[model samples]
Target: MALPSTTVADFSGKYVLNKQLSDESKFDDILAAQGVGLLKRKAVGMVSATSDVHVYADEGGVEHLDITAHVSGGFTSKAERLEGRVLNWTDKEIEHPLFGACTTKSKRVLPAEVDAAELQNGWTPECTAAGVIFIQVVPTSGTDWVSKQVWGIEEINGEKRHTRRFLVTTKKNKTVYARLVYDYAGPL
Candidate 1:
């Protein structure tokens, strides 16, 4: 049965035995008898057919589960850069002790690299076989715009029990932007 779509707050651990699938008697018997390659729900995040059930002789049994699914969606954000350069207030102001004492400086914010090729073609593997759907940043070029800060990925649910992580950064004069996204398929 398909569960309702829900946001995954976090996924990074080994969960205890929950329950075994009881709908398919044949499959259930097979599972109880001989365990399959459990933790195989890396693709769907719900290891329905991949769960293993071990029936103990006396008391409790063992249940190995590995299944999960992701709610399809995206996340986007935007921030204003410092532009070319900021004004040096000290230079325009009267000479005072405060001017000399001022030592703190603002951290420069660089423009996003919204490239055209990236926008059209998308991240080679991020948006394709990898399973990453899309990524678009600011500074999206228009008219005579040079480039943009857009990026995308193609996400893929690999073998069960394996988790996924993606790190983002900016390259320019000074580091100013960063983003991290991840999805845990399930443990086999």
Candidate 2:
């Protein structure tokens, strides 16, 4: 059977984190290169994050996605308009479950166009401006490192859910992968 058609609007709702998995061995080097202390790295590997997503159109018919994510005992929120512009934000320091006080700087690039075909494929196309790809640069004690996050939606067990994948590539070209799976909690 064909999958049910999905639109950006289908993803609007509060989603609670259900599962998270990461490759620890691959993540260690990426964290170390980012100057994360040993203790903090351990803490990062254990923390869980949740997200809420909203999609709407503006007066000019421009599409926007507002996302709020709670992570490591703190929260960060940002909005991306599908106008091909980058939105930047610096968040206040929050108590991290593993790293103590932590602040974050992020840049988000929204899809320039929304393609229904992309959403149906179980992965958001990097070309279409439907989902969001964001890069977060966290400055640690010694140096700064970046984590790239891609957001998408997929149908799981006959229900559509929000998904996020994190990619952290070390200076030496090693890469680590982590994922967060969220289920719909309720309507917006």
Candidate 3:
């Protein structure tokens, strides 16, 4: 459970994936939609993940959230976003273990700014009230899919969980969705 003072608006802590509570049944399908190889997808299904998040503001007062995620087996990725005060996207090039070289960007966004309702709604009340962080990624080569994700905090089984909703769509229009739930570990 999250601390009483914690809220969707400022969830700064380390969280570990609760595989048992996460909606991972469609994870392989989402990976397939992203053109992940059969073996890679299988490997992904066996791994656990964690995210260390930091939410703070720069000297200029622009809020920023930095997330450092590590998937078991030594694979780690970092994502940075401009929070509530800014809605603009900040892009970066990363060599992802699953998606290969990709261009990604993230920003704080409102539900109306999201293209699909599935990606927009379905969050806990606090999540809807605090808004969400939006991310988009496109492989530099090989794959023809674009993945969009939304991050927020939600109440699951009475505990505040760090949740992520994924929407991966291929050039051929094959789309897949998945939800990831994480247990709050502690302050980062």
**Deviation in Å, model 2, residue 121 alpha carbon:** 8.1
- Higher lDDT: candidate 1 or 2? 2
TM-score winner: 3
Query: What are the per-residue Cα lDDT tens digits for candidate 3 across 1-188?
Result: 45345766678898888888777878779988888889888877876777788766678866676767766754454343322223257677777766779988777777668997778876777667667888888999988999999988767777667888899889999888889888788887
> What is the C-alpha local distance difference test score of each model?
0.22, 0.51, 0.76
Q: What is the alpha-carbon RMSD of candidate 2 to the true structure?
A: 8.0
TM for every model, in the order presented, reads: 0.16, 0.52, 0.84
Query: Candidate 2 clash total?
Result: 3
What is the lDDT, from 0 to 100, of the residue 12 in candidate 1? 26
| Candidate 2 clashing pairs, residues 3+ apart or interchain | 111-129, 112-129, 113-129
> Which portions of model 3 show Cα errors greater than 4 Å?
1-4, 73-87
Give the candidates in order of TM-score, highest first.
3, 2, 1
Select the stronger candidate by TM-score from 2 and 3: 3
Q: Model 2, range 97-169, lDDT digits (tens) per residue?
A: 3334445543334544322222123454432355454435343543444466556655556655566656665
Per-residue lDDT of model 1, residues 105-150, tens digit only: 1111111222222233323332233222122222212211111122
